[model samples]
Target: MTTTVARVDVVAVASPKRRRRAPGWLAVVPLLAFVAVAFGIPALAMLDGAFTVRDQATGATSYSAENLSASLRGAYLTALLGSVKLSAVSAALGALVGLPLAQAVVTSRFRALREAVLTASGVLANFGGVPLAFAFVATLGNAGVLTRHLGLTDKGWDLYSFWGLVIVYLYFLIPLMVLTITPALDGLRTQWREAAQNNGATTVQYWLHVALPVLAPSLLGGLVLLFGSAFAAYATAAAMVGSSIPLVTLQIADALSGNVLVGQENVALALSLDMVLVAGLVMAVYLPLQRRSARWLA
Candidate 1:
């Protein structure tokens, strides 16, 4: 009897998706360096200042939570909470109103109209800050043309109020949401809608069962973007209302100028840290949702 021996071999295969080229990585160095210089260093310094305290007489330095603790109570806490509340309310309103408006623009049969609306959105999205505040003041302030014409001021319209700020924010934020969500709306496959229809799904049913589930990530991502925009905003609020409203950004300004927080301490560093933490939290939620949405849209 003749016996044959068989040899077995194993080979490891690398995935193309996991492979990285040296030059592609090299190209990212400049951007990484810029971020390190522009953001990382300043952030590190701010963090150091926030924790470190120096004795006025002895010149002895020690790390402490005094500033941070101070910020968590009284006016500083109120400002922080106010910022969060404003961001949440404005973002929610912007999403609610802007989504249907964006959808309407997307579904419209007129190409020219769609193009015009999108171009306007692009322009308006960036149209904010002092100029925006001024525009609103001129149009909706106590002495504004529309206010005078419609007698809104007599009806108790106050432009400096929180709700007024929401209305002002929506001016740009609605357009921003439109600009932000349009591409995602476009990514929605017409075939999916037709398929849903083929399965005897009504308009409401299709949206409820299919469209909304797919769009949820994008919607949430947009909400976070709006939140960040509203949260970090300073100039418009500063110019419009000054310290009339307790905002974290306004508190930061006051803390820097020796204006003294309600408890007679400067916690600018601590407040900055707080803002950074809040922003970081927003990003923590935003980045993953954005990545997931991008994967789906792609």
Candidate 2:
């Protein structure tokens, strides 16, 4: 009876469980709004115009594929092809020059020298457009300082021609390639080289079999980036050669400004879409390779 009485005390029941709150997504709202305003709206407008034609006389608009069709034909097509060729050649040359330059910088014993080269490359990569074109003109044009001093014009060197554009493009493209590929070069592990050497590999054999294989993805990614940079470039070419060079960007600008034709603004929009698609394709190829290369670095 005493034990039963002692056990009569009661305990309070536990409160009901509460749900955990989820993380807020409000932080991304500003970025989303900015993209919508700055890029999304303009992109939509371009897409709409690309497939539409307007009559300047009546100010009437209608849906049509004529603009796109026109973009793929005649001079427009030539401009597109020329742009591709220019971009490819510049990117290739940049890779050839920049890979070795990047290797030299990365392997340099002096920290100051490496820092100086990287800093200069960063500045030079962004130093394009009108000012860059002007610099080249002052240094290599018909009456340029170098041209006059070296008598290059007397040798029939034209700074306003296709080769001239390539040289100008290289001014920025090589630096851009260096900036892009430097990280990959640095990521190359010292241990890999030692291992190759221990296995009786020569310098060239080690590079060809091990180092190059590892760096290939990153190298290709950098090349694609350079190509896109050269492809989308407008100001430098415009300032240097104007429409004398048949480039897609120049063609787009001409159409928009009515410098080439009247009432062909839709054609310009179509060309813009085509450029976007090409860039998209480049990114499509690049992103996968970049990811693969990053895995090795990590």
Candidate 3:
């Protein structure tokens, strides 16, 4: 009788737990619905716009490849080239500068100073756009404080130049890379380092054999993020250099504003192409690196 009663009690306890877990999956329904409504709708609209054209005679919409093709040859191509160049350069610089900073901070004895630097970097990473543009201009533009003090009134580098944009971008890029790389650095097992040291491995050998392999995925991920951020960025580029620098985002803005290229169908197509190209590039780099990382981490 006691054994039977114990079995009955177990069943009763399990019943409510199973029932409670059922509703947990239902919570995802709202999130999925939200994404379908918000992201799915907008993404489809953008894709549809890429192929849509307006009839000059009747003002009716129709499909046209010529619009997308024309953009591919002119402003779209130029903007893409510029974007790639800018992103690549900035990411390279970030990685070069950030890795050392990450190493220093992670291995530092001065924890307070390291924390302060990390906090400052975090603040600056999010501190781009109009205010950043104005700040740079105030310090580096014509008749600015630094320019005036250094007697560089005429020869002072204008904040409206390509290199100027790069410099401003670097201010944020370096900090972002450091933030991303630091987590990877922290994940490095001290055991592995000690093992390598005990095995009579040189510092360079240890880094090349163990640290680099382990950190590869995080490094690649950071580079991809940096590239994507730079590529899609508009505010800093627009505010700092305006359309004179001829970036892809500026061209898109111009298309919308001026209603250029026949009802601005080209703008949508151009943006689609831009997104697709970036997606493709990132995937190309990420998939191979991810596979390698998985294998290594296994």
Candidate 4:
């Protein structure tokens, strides 16, 4: 009886979510169109030329499988093999050396040391092709700094050889690997390490159970990137060995040059083969690791 009748009051409420219209990418369209015309079309045309044979007399381009088949022998094969071997060795060696450096950078006690190391690594990572080749030539080539100091100019170190190429490749690749792998290591959760230690896990145990599995995707990505960079490199090898060392890029350049390779058709085939090989290598790496990459990033 004492309880007053509750006044029933109802108020209309609106939904909290706001409806959104599809975003307009109007500004980026011109830039995309420019890239399509400028870069994409030219690249596709060059690729098409590789399959097509030209008649010098009439200046006509025709598709032929025969020219491509012929390129499998001689200088083309030699250069291609050399390029693959060099890139593979450099990538493997670089990753092996760089992974530990990345670990050090991420987990190091000294902030100043980490910053300095990372900065130096970045400089060396980007220092490739012309500048790198020149620096090494001055520092390690015949009559170079060390050789001159040791009075070994007469006997001289050869920077034009395969071993010399490997040395130069490693010099550039080590820093690259460090830069690539460091981000992966930095992405690891600190809590995981703390938990592992609290659970009485050893350093090795923690790495094997937690760190490595998480970092695998990044590692694979870095390795693939390194391989691609090494495989397609032209200027560094050229500056170091000139045309004496046969390489796919050098072959492509020769084909483009009127003086060196006589057959434009043959150059096209060589370029096509190089492109296919690179594409295959990338696919082999990418197809397997793409899913893993998403998970790792997540």
How many clashes does each candidate structure show, in the order listed?
Answer: 0, 0, 0, 0
For candidate 1, which ten residues in a row score worst on lDDT? 3-12
Query: Candidate 3, which segments miss by more than 4 Å at Cα?
Result: 1-14, 152-156, 280-298
lDDT of 3 by residue, 102-168 (tens): 8999999999988998999899888888898889888887767887888775665576778778888
Query: What are the TM-scores, per candidate, against the unseen true structure?
Result: 0.88, 0.90, 0.86, 0.81
**Total clashes for model 3:** 0
lDDT of 1: 0.89
lDDT: worst 10-residue window of model 2: 11-20
How does each model score on lDDT?
0.89, 0.92, 0.81, 0.77
Best by TM-score: 2
Report the error of model 4 at residue 93, Å: 1.0
TM-score leaderboard ranking: 2, 1, 3, 4
Q: Tens-digit lDDT track for model 2 on 260-290?
A: 5666778999999999999999999999999
Deviation of model 2 at 73, angstroms: 0.8
Candidate 4 backbone overlaps, count: 0
List the lowest-lDDT window of 10 residues for candidate 4.
Answer: 9-18
Residues 162-237, model 4: lDDT tens digits: 8789889988788989988786787788889999999999999999998888888878888887888788788899
All candidates in order of lDDT, best leading: 2, 1, 3, 4
